[model samples]
Target: MSDEEWERFLRETVKDTTGAPVEPSARAREVARRLREHPRQAEGWRTYSPARPRRRKVWYVTGLVALVALLVALFPQQIVGWFGGDDGGQDGAPLAAESEAPREAPDAEPDLRPTLAEPFRGSPAARWADGAAGITVPPAKATGWMNAAQVERALKQSRDFLVAAGLDSDVLRGERPTKAIALLNPHQKDVQDYLRTALSSKKPDPDTDPLLLFSRFRPEQTRLVGDVVKTRGRLTYREGKRGAVEVTADVTFVYPVTPAADSGRDAEVIRTIVRRKVVMSWDDPAKVITEPGTMSLVSYALDMTNGGCSGPTGYFVPPFGTADEQSTDDDRLIDPYDRSKPVDANDGTTSADDDCATATRS
Candidate 1:
């Protein structure tokens, strides 16, 4: 691994091992700089001061006065013997009274020393610094696709925020607005087309009945909590300019749902199957990684398996797809219109397949 990669790995490893997140302290940095500049003295010596008298008594007052007089009078050695100062004035005789000027108060203690060990710098993943939640805003100005990833992440965050505010769950699906509108307004041709493809695509078998089939969907209600970005691209000065790009998504949001009547059963089943939800968000290639050679486009797929609405789920939807797919029990697949001929299993059915020459077309 490169040095940067190694550093990042080390940082992440440390962060994981220690639950406490390491933060950069300006004070720490400054202290470190000072330590490097002015290291600790080799002597490592410290001086002791006499404790101040809490309450003065007649004897204490008299003794203090006598000691001061002796110290000033060039009899410091005698005074040391009389008191408890070991080797007091041993280094040198008290400066001649005339030459000894009052000492200025010792310089205030320097700021506390910084840590001896290296400062702990967290990894980029652990270093995600979100702004105060709920106070985020749209970009102040359009900076072009240079920050496209940031924009998409921001849009998702915004969708989450709106959902938390009780706007609509479908909006956060990251599909397109048309598909979102179609979910509620199936009468629209766009909505009809989506329903036809999603719901009418297939049919179920004779004995078993199921609840839902289309597996992927975007929650209608969600909100954005925070965002940050790292980029390696040229900032646009005018209308059009482009260069290398790198973007990341950092977001957090909440989804509200009423408690299921049979929480245990729902949990078990939801965890087992994946369901689909509609979305109305956009994707910016600069911010998202995708297969090579595919131009950015609306509509995508999501695997809801493990814990979707009813069970683990997954499916593909076009830009304006709807939420009208049928649900069934078991794995039978049949014609959506006739419900007679078997087409596939688990997946939904659609209109007759007239394109097939060998098999009877629907």
Candidate 2:
């Protein structure tokens, strides 16, 4: 082709491939200037044989293909940008090179630590203000028959005291009920003796503590954990041969299970619901009764672990009760009445009573 026509063709090709104005290479511009300055040499190229021209055309096409392949390999992202793709690269820089550039600093992250609620500081029967794991106190009933506030107070006090004594771990592990036993009302001597015997025994003995035998039947590697999530219930006053007030509560506790040694799995948390009953009596006949009057715990009972009360693991022994009547194998009463036992003057007047007695009375 003529020199002028060749130059125009090269310009158009460059513009089409790069989507930009053609800026001819120095060599190309020099060649064009030489051709323009030398008319005789340009004429000779135009007058070449037809077969020779075809051969030259073939070489030109091959060279053009190689140039295009090289440009595609080196400037792929630039080519993509030319086609409106987001390489975010400038001046034909490779995508990888652009990615290596320093980035702008990111904004600081917000704080995300969990905040713990303050623990209960008021009376025990008052609402438990601080409950973890989404636990909440149920609404109090308006009926004044039973002292709901007193019951709540008792439950909170018992739960907190038990937890502090490590009841969840120590009692289940057959360790001595050191801290927890102190909270038991003195009226529950039989129950106390039974628990002490069970904890002290090296092996399950049927004679000392019959209930010890059932410890073997408990689920292996399973133990009680967690705290009281919520409490709800009502109290009823009974006026009969033996006058007393009773409080029944539905208590929820959580337990976390460790993964089995052989199983490659995550640990799980399980919830257990226990029905607790507390009975209070004012032995003094002359004292006038009030909503939250002076009353002593006489009997306490917690439902058995399994479905029915038939299990060897008798229901949770109340903070007060005679072991003979409430814990025997044959006679298992949820709320038994045995007034024969001397009432524990939980009042501070008696040093023989448990220290918790003073706290409970207050």
Candidate 3:
């Protein structure tokens, strides 16, 4: 065919394959001229060559690889999640966003020991008692006889008696009424008998015997005298089943605990000043008994740092000695009323010695 006819034929063939009319651009015309010049070679194009197919396949594979790499970089977490690997974030969440999420905080510890307030005397007494001794002078009549000075004197007498008796003040410091009663028995036979009979009764009540109130309550285990900072007393007369004059003493002191007891549990040792009330009843205003007994133990109450009072455990009785003889193993007992002489320890042996002799009783 002629050059012009050959170009027209090629354009028509391309238009048929592409389904569009071909424009004769410079490049298209040049390609057409080359095909026309190589007619013998063009005849071979009728049979397909693997060269074009191979090149197309190579480009397709390269594009697919680039797409996969982009997906891996952008959705690493999501890819891991699909394959059952830990994605860190919750289900279906993006890793970048989940990484910046805020976390919840843990709970705090609670306070075990709380702060306690100082004790006061005006507070209600812990224990009270009405002895077997009949009330010859009832509370109403005894009011005229009782005064602050008289009550103060009575309290001092009681303090002196305790110190003189060499009573285990530590045991008395606790709440044990029975132990206290036993300790007082040798000294105050009348008081001891009264307490035993009253406390052992089937219907023992604080109302009947005020000292029974300590059955459930007690002061802290500590030194009572050494802690005493101040002491004051007042006389009160209240009418009840039996009339009696009441002498109340308020003692203020610094509550102390052993260094070992106050360790890491508390940052610093806290010694609090507290006040306690001691009440005693006088059944007969006419009779002049010893200091503490003249005013019987009616009520004794105090505040404790740790908690309630633990009653008396036991008492230590010191051995007695005389100029004529050596010391004996037998415990020297004394009458709470008369400290001048030493009595038997309920055991039959009674050996009076110089140790039992003291100027206070004389």
Candidate closer to the true structure by TM-score (higher is better), 1 or 2 = 2
Top-lDDT structure, candidate number: 2
User: Global lDDT of each model?
Assistant: 0.29, 0.35, 0.34
What does candidate 2's lDDT look like per residue over 240-272, in tens digits? 224333332222222222212222222232222
Candidate 2 TM-score to native: 0.31
Q: Count of backbone clashes for each model?
A: 49, 4, 13
Q: Model 3, stretches more than 4 Å misplaced?
A: 1-155, 158-244, 260-268, 272-274, 285-293, 307-362
Candidate 3 at residue 174, lDDT?
A: 36
Report the Cα lDDT for residue 101, model 1.
18
TM-score of each: 0.22, 0.31, 0.26
Worst 10 residues of 1 by lDDT: 116-125
In model 1, state the lDDT of residue 78.
Answer: 55
Compared with the true structure, what per-residue lDDT tens digits does model 3 show for residues 84-107? 553222222221211111133111
Residue 132 C-alpha lDDT in model 1: 22
Q: After superposition, how far is residue 18 of candidate 2 from its true place, in Å?
A: 94
Ranking by lDDT: 2, 3, 1
